[model samples]
Target: MSGLGFETRQVHAGAIVDAEAGARVTPIYQSAGYVFDSFDDGVERFAGRSARRAYSRNDNPTNVVAARRIADLEGGVDGVLVASGQAAIAMALSALAQAGDHILTTDRLYEGTREMIRGALRRQGLEFEALPIDADEDAWVAAVRPSTRAIYAESIANPLGEVVDLALLGRVSARTGVPLVVDNTVATPYLCRPVEHGAAVVIHSTSKWLGGHGSVIGGAIVDGGGFDWTAAAARFPHLHEPRPHGAPSFAERFGAAAYSAYLRSVVVLEHGPTVPPSSTFLLLHGIETLSLRMERHVANAVAVADALQDHPAVARVHYPGRADGQAERVARLLPDGAGSIVSIDLAGGRDAARTFLDGLRLVSQMTHIGDVRTLAIHTGSTIHGKLDDAERAGLGITEGLVRISVGIELVDDIVADLEQALDAVLAAGERTATRRSAAAQLEAVHP
Candidate 1:
């Protein structure tokens, strides 16, 4: 399979033989529980001594299919399917850190993730420090305190469309003995597998690209199985310590399986952040077409960004693929295209941004990205709206910023709609400014 291509793996990796039904496609085992042959069998299942299933919360056939498929796609040892992308983040972080532990994160994280780190976890006594994604490598090394548990960042940040330097961050992880967790939702495994580049953990929001059609709300955390928890024993007591029932130290018992095994048997099972088997099924289906869809998505996005850069109402376009103004981080990390998301700073600020959004004829204004039809969102008013003025500013989410996720739609039609929208906003802005100036002049003369 290592010699096989991604498209081939996406189509063929996780289909298991149906012993009872003779089904080619993985059947949806929508049941809440599974039965054992005898009382001793149940004990064997609960003890993690058997491969058989015990409860839906622990594992399910449908969920296993999804997890296996995702693991193959991302080159991970195993993956845990969770309720949503946020759940994946919560479970993954909680698995690594406890109360009084600290997490070092990039400030340019997705809005909900930042909220989860700074807002929700802070109240629970867990601490986090935010640093610029493009900060000096030494700055990252210096930020690691004795209590620092993990370093987290997105593969390609939302709205900003900045690609992170995985190898450099990997160096930080190696030096500091802290695992690097990355949210690969934007890039998906189709474009990039962070694990291949030294990420200890790769998390995803299947609601965006992995589910492809935006039909399912799901997420996954893939374990690279390379981080040695015992080496950082003092920092991560949860992984290093022996279990209550003499269940063995996770680092000793599982070794490479430490992160994922803990995530499933401990956090996911106990906290109940399980994805419905039906949702997992949807995600698996979407993954089958992931490679093909991502190619079109990137191509369409490049065309859209190029066209938007030329529009009068577009002040700037932020797509890492552009030649002259490209972020050097992108070339180092994203050798493939920068992904489908394009963030543009519209010329006329908030009001003009709204006009451009309203004038768009074909692109739907939606909260979700990575769909078949083009979608547009104004970050300050929609996705990042939860952040107050100061927070938004800190995150570089300006009032005029419009985030567009290009789909498989015809590049020509998409550009035409954008052109019209931009033209309308600029025309309206010029007229309004002129009218206001004329009105002030007339009032002064009459007075």
Candidate 2:
């Protein structure tokens, strides 16, 4: 499996064959608890002396196969599957930083993540600071305080599609002695593997591109097993300290797998955002065709972006593959493709957005992304609606911004649908101007 290709690994990497039934596909082990052979067997499993399923909350065979497959795809040592992408982020961050600790992140992140960091995490005593997405390396390093325990960013930012400078951030991580944690939800493992650059942990909303379709909602945390948690003992005392019964610390017992072990055993298990076997089964099926779907996704996205750039109603297009100053990064980091998401800012503002959205014939207007069918959403009124005006502007989410999750549909059909919608927006704008001119003339006559 180590020397195999991506497509091959997708189908065969973590598959477990059923001995009695000879089942080729991974069976859904939906049992709440695995039966023990004897009393000693149960004690050994409970005491951590043996490796076997004790409870579904901690681990399940079906979920384990899915986690292993994702870990292999992302080039990680191990992975943990949770209920949703938010759980993955929470578990990974909580495992590394405690109350009163600080986290450094880029400004352009998923709106849900922003809400979690500012609302839930802050109320729980964690502190967070945001640096400009295009900030200089020196500035990023300067932002690191003694309490800063982790550096976080999205591999490809949502809505805006900003590509992270991984090499520069990797250097900052090295200089600051803090692990870099990246949310790779937008750019899946097939497009960009952050661990290959220098990320210690990779997070994914399995509901997105990884799932290909919008059918399942899940998340995963992948540990690269590269960060030295013990070396930074003072900064990460939990990993360095002994267990409740005076057992060896996580770092001593698990070595490179310390963070992952802690995340699974303590954070995920205690918090109870565990992914069920059924969802894991769906996720595994999605991974098998990831490569195929991604190829079509990238092709359709590039075509749609090219068409949108020339539309009369579009003020600006924000696709990385088409943007200036992003070519070099795209060529280096995302040679396969930039991604399938394209966002366009309308020239006529909110009214134009409503007209375009309402007139669309083929593209479905929705709140989700990374589906087989094209999906559209007005970011300002939806995802980023909860943010203040200033915060939304800082993130480049304007009143007229519309995000398109280009699907694996026919390119011609997608373009035709978008063009028709844009045409409707133009006609609506002309009607408004005509009405305003008539009102002015009436006012002059009355005066």
Candidate 3:
């Protein structure tokens, strides 16, 4: 399995062959707790001195399988499953930083992630500063303070398909001694493995593409297992500090997987944002065909983007792989494709977005992305609605921008729906202009 292809590994990695019942598929271990061999065994498990799991909250066989499977796909050492993508972000950050610590991040990210950073995490007393996506390595290094614990960014941003320079950020992480955390929900492990680019931690909202059927909600955090926690002792005292009696510190005990070990044993254990084994069961199934599904997703996206460009109402198409200066970055980072999000800025503004959304027949207008079905949303009004007009403008959230999560449907059908919607936007704009012209004439006659 170590040298297997991604397609093969997605199906086989972290899978358990039940020797007891000879089950082929991983069965759901639905019990609240695992029975121990004896009282001493329970103590061992509780004390983290045994290999057997004592409780289902932190360690369930089914959940472990999903976590390991995602970690394997991302080329990481260890992983943990959580209730949602937000939990993955929160848990990973909580493990790395505490109150009064600072975090550096790229300006472009999912609105949901941004909200968490601005709203909940900020309320917790952790400080955050966003750098421009195009910030150089030196700029990132300069931003790091003694309290800076992490450099966070999304692999491919939401609504607007901005692709961050992950390799550059990875280099920044190395130079600054801060771990790089990446949210790879949009790209998934099939499209991009952040660890290979130098990310110390990889995050995912498995509810999206990983659970391709849109039936389950889950998240995962993967440790790259490369950062030298011992070397960064001054910055990360917890990883280096020894335990109460004679116990070794996380870095001494887990070595490469120290961060993940601490996250699972402490942060996640205390917070208890555990995902159910049933969700993991569905997630595992979705991952089996991830490679296959992503290929079609990319293809449909490229086709849709091409179609949208020729429409009269489209002002711009925000696909990552376009010739828009980032062509090289997209080619280097995302050779397979620049993911399935193809956002179009309408020339007719917010009114046009409303009309276009109203005219959609095949594509579902909703909040979620990376689903098997094509999903569309006006981010300025939904995801970024909390932000005022100025804030939305700063993030390039135009009034008419509509994000399309291209699915594996027939290219023609998807294109047809989009084209018809665009045509309606143009027709609505024309009617409005005509009414305005008639009103102007009436005003002049009255004067």
Candidate 4:
């Protein structure tokens, strides 16, 4: 698998040839539990002493194939699949830090992830401190405390497409002795491998590009197997502590895959947020063509971004790899492409956004990204709607901002659809301006 190309690995890395039925394609092992050989076998399985699985709550053959495939792609020693992207993040963090622990993060992250940090995770007693993405290396090291468990950030942020400097964060992680946990969802392994850039654990919303189609919802947590648990043993007592059943600690037993083993056997098994094997079957099919779909996805994205840049209705385009402050980083980190999310800020604000959305014909108005179909959404009114004006503004979710998840459609067709929408927005804005001016003149004349 290590010597194999990504295209080959995506298809064959974790596939199992069915021994009983001789099935080639991985079958969905949809049963709730595996049949135990005997009472002793069941006991051993439950005790984590057997390679055989006891239940589908944490271990299913189909799901395991998908997990290992994803891990192989991300250059990780092990991987765990959960029900959703949110569940993946929750389980990954839970495995590292518990109540009263702290995690440091780069400020620019997906809104959903940020929400979890500030909301649910905070309420659960885990504290997160965010540093500016551009903060100096010393600043990052200084931010880490004795209780700091991890450094988290997205390889490329959502909607805005802001690329984080992973090397800097990785260096900071090395200095602070905290593992770097990166959400590589937006910049799927097809575009960037964060583990190569010093990430200790990589996270992904396989519901996105990895699953390619918007069919199944799943998430994966991958352990890079690079972080030293023994050196940082004092901070992570659970990994260093012996099991309740008098078994060796996770670090002692699992070696390089200690975090992955802990996450799967401890957090995921206890929480029961297992992704259905049926969904994993669909996910496996999606992953088979990830590289192909991503190539078209990125090509269409760059085309759309280029087309929208000087459009009269667009105030700014949020695509990366352009002539901007992030150009250098984008070139270095995302040389393949800046991903498919191309967000635009409309000059006409909220009303124009409405007209634009209403006028769309080809692109679907929806709340998803990395779909085969191009999807569009107004960020301020949807994903960030719960926050006030100040909060939205702080996160760069403007009144008229539209997030476009560029699909694998023909570049010309995608641009044509977007152009029509922008034109409608501009026309609507002009009409409103004319009406306001006419009313003002009428009032002045009457006075």
Candidate 5:
């Protein structure tokens, strides 16, 4: 599998032939528990002395196959399948940090992730700090506290499309001995592999591009298996502390696989955010065509961004592929393309945004990204609606901002639909202005 190319691996990496039926594709082992040869075998499996599937909550054959495929794609040493992207994040963070610990992240992140950190994780006694994405290495290092357990960021940020400097963060990770965990949901393994740069862990929402059609909801955590947890023992006591019955610490027992082992055995098993065999099947099928879909996705995105940039109704276009301050970083990180999501701010603000969304014909109005169909959403009214006006503004989610998950549809068709929608917005704005002028004149004459 290590010698195989990405496309080949995606199809065959974790697949196993069914001995009894001679099935070609991986069969979904939908059972909750696997039968053991005997009591001794069951004990050995439970005690970790033997390697076999025990229970579906922590390990399942179907889920393992999908997890392994993602691991291969991300160049990770090991991977874990979970119920959702949020579960992947929570499991990864819980594996390393406990109460009274801190985690540093770039301000640009998915709205759900931001909510998770500030809401649930904060309630669990973890502290999170958000810093600017373009902060220098020294600034990032300075932000690190003695209690800092991890550094987190997205490979390519959502909506705003900011690309992180993985190498700089990797250097900081090396100097500070904190593992860098990246959410590679938007960029996908097809566009970027965070581990290749310096990330110790990578997360993905398989519901997005990995599932390809938005048909399934699943998530995965890929461990690079390179971070030395023992060296950072003081910062991460859980990895260093001995097992309850005098067994070796996770760092001592699993070595490079310590964090992954802890996440799978302790966090995922106990927390019960397990990925189902059915979802894994869909994710595996989706991954088989990941490379092909991503190529078309990127091409369409470039076309859409270009069209949006010159539109009269658009105030600003937020796509990394464009020439901007982040252009160099984008080129270095996303040579193939910036990604399939393009966000634009409408010139006429909220009312025009509503009109544009209402007038769209071909593009679907939805919250999801990475679907085969083009989707659009007003971020200010939906994803970031929970935040106050000031908070939303700070995050670059303006009232007029619209995020488009550019699909693999023909470029001309997509552009045509968007152009017509923009035209509707402009016309609506003109009508509103005319009505206001007429009302003001009538009021003055009557008075």
Candidate 6:
């Protein structure tokens, strides 16, 4: 399978036929528990002596299929599926860090991730620091503290359209003995494999591109199988500590898959954030077409961004494919494609932004990105609206900012919808200005 190409991997990686039924499609094992052959087998399973399903909360057949496929696709030893992207991050962080421990994160992360660090994790007695994603290698090394357990960043930052230099970041990880945890949701495994770039852990929100049609919400954590967790025993006491049934030490027992095994066995089993079997099936269905779907998604996004740049009402368009200020970074890291998302700033303010949104007929006005349907969202008024003016500015989100998740639709149709919407906004502004002037003139004549 390692010798197979990506197209072959996408179609055949996760789904091997069911042992009993010989089913071609991965069967959904929706049952909560599996029957053990005997009392001895059940005891062995509980003691971690035998490898079989003890409970659905611990593992599921359908979910494992998706997990195994993702692991193979990303070149990881093992992968675990969670309820959502945030869950994946939370579980990964909890598995690695505890009270008094710290993590270094990129400043350009998703707002939800930033909020989780600043609002919740910090309150729990953990320290999280933010650094510029495009910082110099020396600057990143300088930011590391003795308490730092992991360096976290997105492979490609959402909305901002900036790509982190994974290779350089990997070097920083190697120098400081920190495992780099990358959110590979935006790029997916098709465009980039973070493990090859030196990431110890790769995380993805399968709700986005992985579940290509945006039907199911899921997340995955892939262990890169390279980091040496045993040597960092003092940094990660949880992995070194004893287990309930005197199970083997995580690093010694699981080897390269220590992080992933800990996440599923401890974090998920104890907390129970299991992805449903139906959702798992939906995700599996989407993954079969991942390579094909993403190609069109990237192509369509580039064309839409090109059209966006020419519109008069558009102040600026942020698409990595366009080769602007972040062109060097895109060229270096994402030479294949910029990705499916495009962030734009309209000339008019919030009101005009709303007008443009209302004027759209072909595209959907939804918050979620990376779907087959073209979608648009104004962050200042929707997704990032909770942030204060200063906070929004720090995030590079303006009052006029709108994020577009370009889909695999016809390029001409996407451009036409945008063009007409911008025209309608300008037309409405002219009418309002004319009315205001007429009222002022009338008042002067009456006086």
Query: In candidate 2, what are the lDDT values of residues 322-441, reduced to their tens digit?
Result: 665888998999999988999999999989999999999999999988899999999999898887899888788899999999999899999999999999999999999999999999
lDDT of 5 by residue, 12-113 (tens): 987889889998988888889889999999987777667787888989988988888899899988899999999899988998888899999999999999
Clashes of each: 0, 0, 0, 0, 0, 0
lDDT of 1 by residue, 230-347 (tens): 7888887778788767768777888998889888988999999778888877788888999888889999998888888878788888887464344576766676778999888887
CA lDDT scores, all candidates in order: 0.86, 0.90, 0.91, 0.92, 0.91, 0.87
Listed in order, each prediction's TM-score against the native is 0.96, 0.98, 0.98, 0.98, 0.98, 0.96
- Tens-digit lDDT track for model 3 on 1-447? 589999999999999998799898999989889888899998888888798898888899999999999999999999999999999999999999999999999999888888889899999999999999999889999999999999999999887888999999999988888999999988998889999989999999999999988788899999998887888888889998886676888899999999999999999999999898988899999999999999999999998988888788999999996746898998899988889999999998899999999999999999888789998998889888899999999999999889999988888999999899899998998999999999999999996
lDDT of 4 by residue, 1-447 (tens): 889999999999988999999999999898998799999999999888999999999899999999999999989888999999999999999999999999999888888988999899999999999998889899999999999999999999887888899999889888878999999999999899999988989999989999989998999999998888888899888998999779899999998889999999989999999899999999999999999999999999988998999999999999986655998999899988889999999988999899998899999999999999999999898898888999888878899899999999888988999999889888888898899999999999996
- The weakest ten consecutive residues by lDDT in model 4 span 315-324
Candidate 1 similarity to native, TM-score: 0.96
Instruction: Supply candidate 6's per-residue lDDT for 417.
Output: 94
Alpha-carbon RMSD, each predicted model = 1.7, 1.2, 1.1, 1.0, 1.3, 1.5
For model 5, give the 10-residue run with minimal summed lDDT: 320-329
Ten consecutive residues with minimal summed lDDT in candidate 6? Answer: 320-329
Query: What lDDT score is found at residue 216 in candidate 4?
Result: 89
The worst-scoring run of ten residues by lDDT in candidate 3 lies at 240-249
Better of 1 and 2 by TM-score: 2
